[model samples]
Target: MSEAARETARFAALAEQSNVGPHTLDQLQADIRRVVTTYPSRPIEPLFHEVRELRDRAFNLLEGRQAPHHTRDLYLAAGLLCGVLANASFDLNRYHEAETQARAAFLCGELAGHNGLRAWLRGLQSLIAYWDGRPRDAVQLAHAGMEFVPENGTAHIRLASISARAWGQLGHRTEALAALRQADEHRERLTPDIEHDDPGGMMSFPLAKQHLYAGTTHLWLRDPTSLTHAKEAANQAIQLYQADPPERRRLGELALARVDLAQVHLATGDLDAAADQGHTVLGLAATRRTESIDKGLDRLARHLNEGPAATSPTAIGLREAITHHRARALPPGETT
Candidate 1:
């Protein structure tokens, strides 16, 4: 082609590109980071709205022809928004909606060919599957994610933890333990000082979160030895969470850790301790409660009913408290 024709074509292409500048992309990224980091400290209802707004903005920017440099950034921002929507929807008891958002996030990640985003989205899908009572699917998704981030990172750690939980839920103790060990190894190699694709907050998995998963996995395994491990892990998770600053702290995680402690105490026949921990967890913000936490409490309740505590005064009081708190915690028209 002639130089003049080539110049004309280049100018036309550049003119067609949308006005999503680098500053705009950076701001969107920062907003997404804030949404993820503040997730544990706020209500899901508000976050859901915020995520939707972000998603819409991202979709708009992606509409017209975009500069090559802007394409990946737009995809990453959209993926992050979808991820936040998925998690917030799940917290609001909208399981199907959560799954839909998770799939959208996965697609965005694929478009960007972002390993970290893909891995994190897979972990989210695994979590939703686990809550929806599909342990096999959860295990598959978690393992698939692990393939993308084999080296130590938040995605690797989260995928491993979720995989361990899925294996335990499926009664595969060997695989569960292996996954847990793998998570620990990744954690050891993970440097908090380094900036990863997905930093702390919802995208990253910390040691405290790993302990919570360990506790949950042990509880699912239901072995006498496992109960001891569960109790210890739960305690460790609680301690680690408590050590964080107020803004850095996640109320939902603290509640989960407390419930895990309650479950451990109940399993060990410490009725008073179990009741206290249960009450403490129940006192946390109900609007922020996740399905996982609800499921854990359900297991604890069942344990209380089946054991000798069934007729004990402490158990009776605890049951009543749970019922009352659940009624208040869950939104109207929602059930545990």
Candidate 2:
């Protein structure tokens, strides 16, 4: 191009001011980080509304004029906010809404050219599929996430772990174990984000949650050979959860781990240990209840009935307790 044309273009670009300033972008980034870090442990209803408002604000900003870099930043924030909304909908057992939000989030990630957001959105979609009784879909989504490995994030590890659980659910033992091993390998060589502040909570897959995932996968495998592995993993998850501060502990995940531990105990004919785990899960207040946790409790109750202790008073009482516990919330909602 001629120098005259290039000069005009450069001047035009320089004259185009962004609707949002750097401080605005910084504030949006900070808010996104706060939501990402706390959503796993906080009550969902309020966070749901907060995320919705933040996402709407981002969308509105995008509607106005902005520089290319600022537009990308806004898109990234909007994408993450949409992801949190999807997660909240999933926690409330609204699968359709969750998937819809996930799709929007993925689109935002694409617009922003953010591998981390895109990969994490895929994992979130897989999780919704896994819980909504679609193991095949879950596995596919997890694989799709693998296509966009971020430079430094746990999304890839989370994808593999999610796929492992889905494979186990489908009784694909070899595939399940392979996925688990892949996740472990990723973790061993993981390069922490340069600042060591890779968003914690739901965004990053911690070791405790990985162990919990393994326990769940083993339970799905239902193989006698893997029962020992399952028990050990579940115990490790429980210990790790207890080691964290009470505020940081993911209660629903911890409860599900306990329920899986109980299942293993029941399978091994250790009725007392199973009952202890069952009681611990049931102790969680209804306000903190999650759909996954409810299903785990129901699974435990069914396991009780299937075991040799089906006719025993302790088994009967626990089964009845689960029935009542489930009744307390009917299907647990995001709002208390």
Candidate 3:
């Protein structure tokens, strides 16, 4: 099909999927995939902005705060948008923003009576908590979300991703691996129809993201298998990012920096290279609001501290940049 025709078809599919009966989540997911694949140029920012407006309108309508024509679907769309925005913030290394957006998304989903979306928002919250260095909280949240929406395929995937990371953080290698396996199993069962129904509002949860999560989890476990998974995910993400618009390139860069640093350190035991990438992460973090990226950088920093390598020039430069940024944020008396 022609590009424009294909885009139109994809969009129509998304609308149709969104209008599907509540129980037909698989069809909903298929529509989401069509939208994601067809609109690679669409940035997360504009999407979130639109979602924020829609959410406001939906809440107003629900509370008799606005026009009466608003429906539950508006609320659902808002929740989805909020979730996507939170994910975007996480991608940008803005943890605080991610947490706020995720919480808002959860609240909106709850008010909308969208249990599945609420579960997904909880998963995002768990991920943010994990990145904030609260593994136990992350685990609790993930488990709670899983319990709330046990049959939701998207929730299962989200739970698996967070569970793997949280377990790895707690040093539960077997549990982490099991969770990773569960995510893989879900992926295997996934069909194009299912992918199109993705209700996350953004297409962040692809196979590459699964691999990236698995690789990072193994990295935390200090397992040799991490290198292979990281390499593959990094390569695939790179290719996809290259094909994407400039605005979306940051996600790929962030992911690449993460896997590259991890793989390089694993291969050469080079703390300098790891620190360099960690520095890159820090730089990216300053501009974006993603807790996950910041967490990854913090992990790399810890690794560097544990190792014996002298801080490379790159590392020192990054440190200087971070120091300056922090100083700027400090009150005058606190600056010293």
Q: After superposition, how far is residue 170 of candidate 3 from its true place, in Å?
A: 0.8
Provide C-alpha RMSD values for all models, in order.
2.9, 3.3, 11.5
Flag the better candidate by lDDT, 1 or 2.
2
Q: Write the per-residue lDDT of candidate 2 for residues 160-192, one digit (tens) a residue.
A: 999999999999999999999999998887764
Model 1, 176-293: lDDT tens per residue?
9999999888777767554354644788777788899999899888789998998899899999998999777877888888988887788787989999998888777464666666
Question: What C-alpha lDDT do the candidate models reach, one value each?
Answer: 0.82, 0.85, 0.59
Q: Output the TM-score of candidate 1.
A: 0.92
Report the number of the highest-lDDT candidate. 2
Arrange candidates, best lDDT first.
2, 1, 3
Per-model TM-score on C-alpha atoms = 0.92, 0.91, 0.67
- In order of TM-score, best first, we have 1, 2, 3
Between prediction 2 and prediction 3, which has the larger lDDT? Answer: 2
Model 3 poorest ten-residue lDDT run? 327-336
